[model samples]
Target: MLLKSITPRESEKIIKIDRFVFTTFANIEALEYELSLGIKKIEAINTNYYLKIGGNEERIAFEAKIYLEYLEHFSGLVEKIKAREPLSLSTLESTKIRKILIDSFSAKTKDWLLDSSRNATYYTKEFSIGGVVL
Candidate 1:
């Protein structure tokens, strides 16, 4: 399945965990340097985890699914970088390099959009939750 079912509460927790993972990666100076090299592909690696986006929610087995995905993607990227592989856009961008770049940007963008839209300041006011009027 493309999306996993998660309660709103569980989804919130996953989001927090995702933020921490992103922070760790963003703190890497080499990552910034690599990003500047350019994106070879816009698509990203497929993730097993997903947050409920305004739809039917399901129970999550654990909160670590997202973490595991982050670890998998990060490990792959590190391996490619360590092997002296190119991590940038090029007419001849290798499959490995393209996969890494795509996964990195996809995760980053997903977290950004989730965090940006999760402002408590706006939610503090009267509004609906899970599409149901409060």
Candidate 2:
């Protein structure tokens, strides 16, 4: 007997994966404000990740850590730019910084998906169809 496999419907599957892109940008803005006020020591910045399936949501912790590291890297670049001249970045400079963050995060996420240990089970559950778990 050939058993058929069942997959989740489009509505049940993960509909959106949200990264803390804006949150990182906002934190960097706040950091710049503090620096302008002569604040040397700044608090750590954190990022978050979320997966949505219909009305359900799952918070991703491990991936958030990786994202936080990249956020810090971007923050360092901003600090360097600030140190050179306490002025806002030029249009070209802003574009380069945005590209760096986009490319770096894209590459990292691709690499992460390639790892065998990283599976959908992290945010999904096994479902049985006709007494068979697929």
Candidate 3:
């Protein structure tokens, strides 16, 4: 997801968000925020985000579109949650849907990414889909 997820004030540089994958609606909101601020560009329908969480590749390749207007004001909305669904890293039997997003990384990797303000906010997920925190 590092490739798809981006920070809004990331170097004032424009990046393309070819595709985004969030199990929860919060992830969608977070992605919308970045795009609205021009932090990154969510690619069109023909193309999409490729996020292979572990061996979960099928669901990761799902298709979706990012509306033009939503990308225009993403910054304002990321702060205002749309969905709120609390979730777990794994489910009892639902493997088709994207599972809860638990940061799976070494302490060093997380520390390095968060210590720097340019990347600190990257680790902090926001919004939710009916309580499923993304």
Candidate 4:
């Protein structure tokens, strides 16, 4: 007779995303603003930038991309408001901005499970009566 040995195997998956490049001047400012919110700076800033938040590089890039897109989407409207010099928002424009704020809170990725692995387990129970196994 042979007894099988139980063993558990574990692994950690790390994904390293390629550094993101800022194309537009507004995107650079957006990046700076994002960094300021967290009081963070580029880890390696030479030809490109290396950014991470809570040790997640992908999240940093993902957020920057979203901010850039948001800025691009509303740039024209923003410029129009600014062009007035006084930069006053009409009731309609104010309502639109409020809607944007509401939408921003719901922004989330479809999948955030970046890493996973299969796991195994085993259990045993021992019985004894009057200092003798039964």
The residue-by-residue lDDT of candidate 4 on 1-134, one tens digit each, is 31223111112101111111122311222211122223345555455454544531111111222232223332343233234332211121122211111111112223223334644322221111011000
TM-scores of the candidates in the order shown: 0.18, 0.14, 0.15, 0.15
Q: Which scores greater on TM-score, model 1 or model 2?
A: 1
User: Cα miss at 105, model 1 (Å)?
Assistant: 17
In order, what lDDT does every prediction score? 0.25, 0.23, 0.28, 0.22
Question: Would you list the clashing residue pairs of candidate 1?
Answer: none
| Candidate ranking (lDDT, best to worst) | 3, 1, 2, 4
Candidate 1: misplaced stretches above 4 Å? 1-69, 89-134
Candidate 2 lDDT (Cα, 0 to 1) = 0.23
Model 4, residue 119: C-alpha shift (Å): 40
lDDT of 3 by residue, 1-134 (tens): 54235433423312212122223222232221111122334577798654433322111111122332233334433333222222232221233334332222111111125455565422332222222223
Give the lowest summed-lDDT range of ten residues in model 4. Answer: 125-134
Top TM-score: which candidate number?
1
Better of 1 and 4 by lDDT: 1
Q: Please give the lDDT score for candidate 1.
A: 0.25
Regions more than 4 Å wrong, model 4: 1-66, 85-134
Q: Model 3 reaches what TM-score against the true structure?
A: 0.15
Worst 10 residues of 1 by lDDT: 125-134
Which candidate wins on lDDT? 3
State the displacement of the C-alpha of residue 101, model 4, in Å, after optimal TM-score superposition. 19
Report clash pairs, candidate 4. none
